[model samples]
Target: MATTKSSSYHHGDLRHAVLTAALEVIATEGPGALSLRDLARRAGVSHAAPAHHFKDRTGLLTAIAAEGFDLLADALADAPDLRERGVRYVRFGVEHPAHFQVMFLPDLLRGDDAALLAARARAGGELRAGVTGMPEGGRGDDARLAGIAAWSLAHGFATLLLSENLREPVGERDPEEIFRALAELLF
Candidate 1:
């Protein structure tokens, strides 16, 4: 017998269960492997249960993306300084690899989603705040250029770390530590 949507999972929070399962799958196998059916199975819910929370795969990824940006925005807002902001960014990426992966890949998201747009703008604004007074010379676009540079440095470093491309170069060093040392040269 198949589990009923409402009674399948012991917990009533089926949405959370399904989302948690989706994150686990994305974390281990990448977003490409995410499927509503798989998520429902992982959550021990009825096959149609996930659809109640997320209409489809795109809906699932969009929810994750929106929530991830909100998380990032919160982290960035709490940083005391530029270096800390960069560190927080890297930490957020490392800790939430699945979200980090899906966030930047616009193709996987509903670009016009109000929640996603608001969250993206919030995170982007926070990042720009960190670079508004930068010293980079960019033909009257210093702040713009600075934001791009800062984002690139932090994001690229985080991507490398997450992909395990820095294991040899970093030699088991904590990501925040390596980042601090590297950031000292620029910031």
Candidate 2:
């Protein structure tokens, strides 16, 4: 059963509905296909409703990126080690492809949104925290480099897996299992 525009929605429900519809649009068609009018139609609201909530397309994308980073932070929070964190990162990317796509593309979002910046910082902090071998004093340049390498590895692998670029080599194996093997080799 799909939620329709005629469905009675409370104060905040419409905003949530619009965001949900936008994510669906991104998932099925890609972010390039996203439009406030289309999302309004999908959410059973007037074409202007999305604009009222988001102000503009960039506003909507900023919200999505912020939400995505928050979700990523939560997903990575419980991992016990660098390898497990990398596994979680890959899993998050696979599970939330739409969010993953929007979260990283700076050109599509309002980079100065305070909430978005905070959320992104939190996610970055989590990623850095995963590099447990850092020296005790403070995260030196080496730790920063190591974190970047780990993030690149997980993000690259996840992107390749999602695009089916690695299908031949990864056939029949769960992405997480493959990620774990790779993580062990690297970290």
Candidate 3:
């Protein structure tokens, strides 16, 4: 007979473990299924453990959204051109579906979170930077509109691909290659 340990977390790492477990759950069951109790169970910790790091489900989801934005910034940071950045944006959405889904659903996150605000700004800046021939000074309406257009294109394509709406039309074709061709045609 074997006995299971009540808690598996080591010293000072419970928060990390919980977040990892939360992401796993999101990947497997979707963000709608996330709950602190469920995450705590998945992390092999006490039901109250997650409260130490996140006040509630909104806090946890906000943190995930913030982290997602930071990851998006990093992914777009090294792109050599606008088209490459667009491709990377779609790639990030496809690869990190759990994060991508949570990051965009405003109702599921804490809109007032400072970390989330800052990360959102960073991601927005990265996207704006990828646009060519913007005004020399601060972003103008034209630049902002361009950024929105680019984002819409990448996001729309990624969403379709993830939903399998393009499977038949895109048979034997890589999403990234298709995105590259589309970017060439548009930009």
Candidate 4:
């Protein structure tokens, strides 16, 4: 574990550390437990230090959500196919349990910030564009719907898994197979 004293307060990465610590708080204690002061303390910075990077709690959360979307976009981009993107999203949610929890639970974070909204839109656009580029259909509403459907399915599956709602034996089948099965059953 990296000691707080070893971390540079004046370094360019302090903001990132604060955000990362805030995420840890959110994951372990729920978003309600997250606070600028607490994050600063955890990062071994003064209480007022977070204020230098984030105007308030909202700013901090907005940054976290933006970071989440950027990561999601990258994960989606790396997938080889539409189905693979869905699998990748599920994988990302599982791997980034903290970000995934806060990103979807809008009640846990500030969802009203303009910057956050723009970042979310950019991520959404990236997902939609990836789907639109697929050979399955032409770009536009159809492709957008495909993107939405894919995202919804993956998100729902991930949420269910996190909540332990899907107790069925989902072994060896892989996420793609499960996704296809769900799509066939629902849509």
Candidate 5:
């Protein structure tokens, strides 16, 4: 493995490679199984290679969470309406289950990492935009409350679907459609 990837340690995109490997591991084994040494093995680099980018496990988790929030912000921005935001939110969770698993767990992240904070704030702003679009409500407290409600619905439904708790009840129907229907009814 070292012979095959000797050049990678010196020339390849080491940070991205390790991050992808870490995400793959998380997808299969959950975050508890994540280790810099394991990630290095998966990426075919020396065990210390990951540390150059992430410093430690907490740093790696923080980077993953930061990336997740950025992706979420992009997804929410692409959505056409508040209902669609909820739909896309669920879709994002389903599509990026590894990121979904680690993104919101504050205890698993550095919490105050600048990139994480900025990415989280960006995602938060996108979610708030959905509520701000509500014509009936004024700004400030009304918008804040509505944003909370909207986020609660999307996040709760996404969490349920990820846990497969909704599979039996939701059956084979598209979860995005189900979430759209639920959002329509509740909102």
Candidate 6:
């Protein structure tokens, strides 16, 4: 049974509910369809209730982008090896396409949002650590360059994979497997 939340947001979990609904909406429809009224309706709250959680549309998008980055950071941090982290980054993008899409689309979010900026920093630090973890005197611009290279490859591959643009003949191996193999070869 669904319990009704009180009108007062401070009395319940309306804020989190609204955010979750918003993410689902954006993931399915993309950011173009996002609105506070839509989110409120989806969350079964008054239109004004969203204002209590998100000051405006930008605030909501900012929160979504921050959530995406935080998730990416956590996934990257869990990998015990640089190559594994690269694979995990690609997997995160593949699994969280909507989050991945909005996180990189700068125009959908407030660039100056503190939470977004901090989350981005955390994600970058994880990527950079993976870069610097490379063996054999991984101490120079090489590590930084390797990080950037890995990130670009994983992001590009994930994007292409999500779009199914890499569909090949029946003789081809798994798309992700092929992509990872190429990543190992090139990076």
Off by over 4 Å in 2: 8-11, 133-141
lDDT of 5 at 94: 90
Tens-place lDDT digits, model 2, residues 1-187: 2358766244457888888888888888999998998888877778898898799889998999999999999999967878888899999998999899999999999999998999999998888888854454433557767788889999999999888899999999888999999977766
What are the models' TM-scores? 0.89, 0.92, 0.89, 0.80, 0.92, 0.86
lDDT tens digits, residue span 39-145, model 4: 87788888998899888887777778878887888887755656667777788887887788777767656777776787788778766765766776343457667
Per-residue CA lDDT of model 3 for 5-108, tens digit only, reads 23346656677777777777787788989999877777777788789899899999999999999999999996887788889999998888888888999999
Q: What is the overall TM-score of model 5 with all chains considered together?
A: 0.92
Question: Residue 34 of candidate 5: its Cα lDDT?
Answer: 94
- What are the lDDT scores of the predictions, listed in order? 0.84, 0.86, 0.83, 0.74, 0.86, 0.78
Separate clash counts for every candidate: 0, 1, 0, 0, 0, 0
Tens digits of per-residue lDDT for model 6 on 31-131?
Answer: 88888987777767778988987799988888888999999999999677677787888788877877888899898789998999999999999988877
Model 3 CA deviation exceeding 4 Å by range = 1-8, 132-141
Off by over 4 Å in 1: 1-11, 133-141
Better of 3 and 6 by lDDT: 3
Instruction: After superposing candidate 6 on the true structure, give the runs of residues whose Cα lies further than 4 Å from its correct spot.
Output: 1-11, 136-141, 169-175
Q: For candidate 2, list the clashing residue pairs, or say none.
A: 5-44
RMSD (Cα, Å) of model 1: 3.4
Name the regions of candidate 4 deviating beyond 4 angstroms.
1-3, 107-115, 134-141, 171-177, 180-187
Return the lDDT, model 1, position 37.
90
